[model samples]
Target: MESFKSILSAKGPSLFLLPTWMEQNEYLTAGFTSRNGGVSEEPWASLNVGLHVGDQDADVVRNRQLIAEAIDWPFEAWTCGEQVHGSDVFAVTEVERGMGRLSRASAIADTDALITNVPGVLLASFYADCVPLYFYDPEHQAVALAHAGWKGTVQQIAIRTIEAMEKQYGSKPEQIRCAIGPSIDDCCYEVDGFVIDKLQPLVQELANLVNSVPESMLTLVENGKAMVNLKQINRHIMLKAGILPIHIELSEWCTGCSSDQFFSHRKEGGKTGRMASWIGIRER
Candidate 1:
């Protein structure tokens, strides 16, 4: 079954929700947003929650507010980072809550991942063709969000997040639930030798964990470029990091293929809006 289920309404912002997770824990709110039903114009056309993508800050904030309202989360609880496509992980405290919701300057600087055990603090990250990784530790009631592009993936941002959770919240990997949200898939993500070379070491190590060969994670094609399955690579990384396979949920929605529903930097030639992946435990 698809992990991220679409929630659409004629007059409301479109969202893709993790029904299973929400059903398992009523206080938890986790999902991704689609690029429909916002106030941005032209390339941003609709629901663009990224404040750094040159979209009108007012429009982006409104879009984010719409998502918060739709999910019944306080807009003030929305916390985010100034994603730099690096492996840096920031552990958000209550003080950091709502930092980047209104503007980029207030966002956590130079971080690609944000983890927090603080209830009511919504952890959100923007994405356009890059992977959105979600982590939840029900035992500790902690939730996290990571933005993974090729750079972050090769840097092993997933492991960094899990380790951070372990250190900050005592979250055991076996008890951690992880979900890979919509992004550019191998079908749409082609990389050159520079990227493939960076992935080579990790792919070699991942081979021992997966049943299939490393090629399943990174397939080399003609002209010296390779199709990188970032989602699978992340899953394997999670597995290697001790997260159970059953605890991992992967989405099939490809941003490149679903331009009508997502923002794809590659498919849209870098001039595009962004969708958000958010996870938080509502305050009681």
Candidate 2:
């Protein structure tokens, strides 16, 4: 019953696809990329889709293009954001459909989330240990991607993306299907007081709203630190925003634990490449 299923291709990039979403709508292509099947070299090793992570820009773009080809999406439709780990969500339009695919300068700036109802426009966001949040509104045919590191999670970027979808595409939260993609899990994500401070209030608020306990989302460890479950916290935010529990899919692939298949910033000491989470409605 795993929501994200791995699909290995001999000719192109390997992917972890959200099968239910693709099954529900054949025109939809939604999945996370594995750090395999690309043209980049060491640290980046293979499939690094991030343009700003010190990898050669051409290599990154080639990797991204390989992904686009693997998914049957036009490389020109591959769009992205300049993630700043904030709660800002940018509503992508037709005019901005292909920005940031080739370089960081053309990408949507200072945004952690990108939503679009436009067909043929791929919304992609890069991640190392950060969480990748996916939102799809079947009724509106809109898809969104959010990059939620601890900072963005604390800022409630999940809620911001849902609200933006509601405002821009009339997407009712209850009708919105969400997915939490591969990232570092609580088992491998230990943080200091600085992060815990930001998370505590949000965890408390979520507990009060859901009638649960804050400890369910965070575990205290030695030296004023905690092992945080960012994916669960974001799921709670989705619930608090009115997305039904049945409508959300959570992935169990932990980047830190599965570093051979993913690029883990924590496991690799901040010098790793990035994987991409992408969602788009293919042109009919």
Candidate 3:
């Protein structure tokens, strides 16, 4: 895995990514988005791209347009899916274009991950509290994006995404670079005894549980909710699959903490809009 930096650009209040990435000859590049810029106003603020948050339909469309321009796209060509916090990941292709729109389709039907190698095809996963994970294999010119909340993380969606990459592109876990985008960090995440009770026994029994932190200080013998570090758990999953420790990039920004910059379902609740994490390659 090579080191790559995602450059940030501000267009109005919306934030966009620059054109820089490490990839294969067939063309595989990607970037995560920051919650700045766009057309929505007030509660949704300036650039809300999520339609499920009760923002105006036209505002969301205009916001996507501006964000697309920020990335220098003539028009945003994106493929989205219903994120169910399950392990299903759709392969983006020219055949299906109507799978994940909140107007026609909500981001909450099924499938929490997306993998694609199609150029000019952007795979965007929506989330406010759920972790958005990304995968890039320079060896296979393939990429994948995942939306993992506690349920998804517990199910090891990251590992499954890698498994999909290997099956689809022959990508080795060691050769893949995983990026854990901004989400609700431990500082802003809290769980109860029930959560710890369910997780402690499982993690403690793992052959690769390098470190264990619960949602609380409950002893493994006693049920206590420990503040599970989601980012660490995702990295652990990658390492468990043989991905290099150094190959993982954890975005230090916490959406709950940076709610000023990003949306947070935990902080904003049902009324808040979602932020999107996307990645794409140029096929031409």
Candidate 4:
């Protein structure tokens, strides 16, 4: 079964929820938002939750609030980071619980991944086509959200997040459950030589770790370009980081292919809305 199950209604935020995770842990909530049922205008028409995407601040906040309401999370707990496509992982603390909820300036700076053992601090990251990597260390009641574009993927953001969880929360990698959310799949994500070159070393390392072939992560096309599988590469990276394969959930929804259901920066030619991936444990 597809791990990210869609929950749609007539007039609310459309969501793809991780039912198994939420069901297994009563206090936990994890899912990705869709581009429908919001208040933005064209290009970013409807549900665009990104505050920095040139959308009206009020509209964007309202959209975010709609998601928070739908998920039954307080909007004040919606914490986020200013994604720079880097490998830096920040452990969100209680004092920083609501940073970036209303504005970008208040958001955690220079980070692509946010991890927290702090219950009630919802870790959110925006994405259009970039992969959204999720980590849950049930042993520590901690969760994380990572934004992985090609740059962050090459830099091994997933590994960085695992390390952060281990160091900050005493989370064992073997106990961390991971999920790759909706994003541009290999069929829709074509890359040039520059990206391929950056990925070559890691691709080789992934093969060695999983005893898999290069094509499992990168398929070379013609004219110095190739189709790259960010999700699979990140999965291999998670395996290399000591996460069990059975504990990981991978989404099949491709943003680039399903523009109606998602906002694809690549398919939409860069003027697009952003969906959010969130994981939080309700304060008890």
What is candidate 2's TM-score against the reference? 0.98
Candidate 4 wrongly placed segments (more than 4 Å): none
Q: Which is superior by TM-score, 2 or 3?
A: 2
What are the models' TM-scores?
0.98, 0.98, 0.84, 0.99
lDDT of 2 by residue, 1-284 (tens): 67899998777888999999999999999999999888899989899988877999999999999999888888999999998989999999999989999999999999999999999899999999899999999999999999999999988999999999999999999999999999999999898998898899999999999998888799898989999999999999999999999999999989999987999988898887999999999888
* Candidate 3 ranges with C-alpha deviation above 4 Å: 1-13, 16-29, 74-76, 97-102, 106-109, 205-224
lDDT of 1 by residue, 1-284 (tens): 78999999688799999998999999999999999988898889899988877889999999999899988888999999999999999999989999988888999999999999988899999999899999999999999999999899999999999999999999999999999999999999999999989998999889876665998799999999999999999989999899998999999999999999999999999899999999999878
What local lDDT score does residue 218 receive in model 1, on the 0 to 100 scale? 93
**Number of backbone collisions per candidate:** 0, 0, 15, 0
lDDT winner = 4
lDDT of each: 0.93, 0.93, 0.68, 0.93
What is candidate 4's TM-score against the reference?
0.99
* Whole-structure CA lDDT of model 2: 0.93
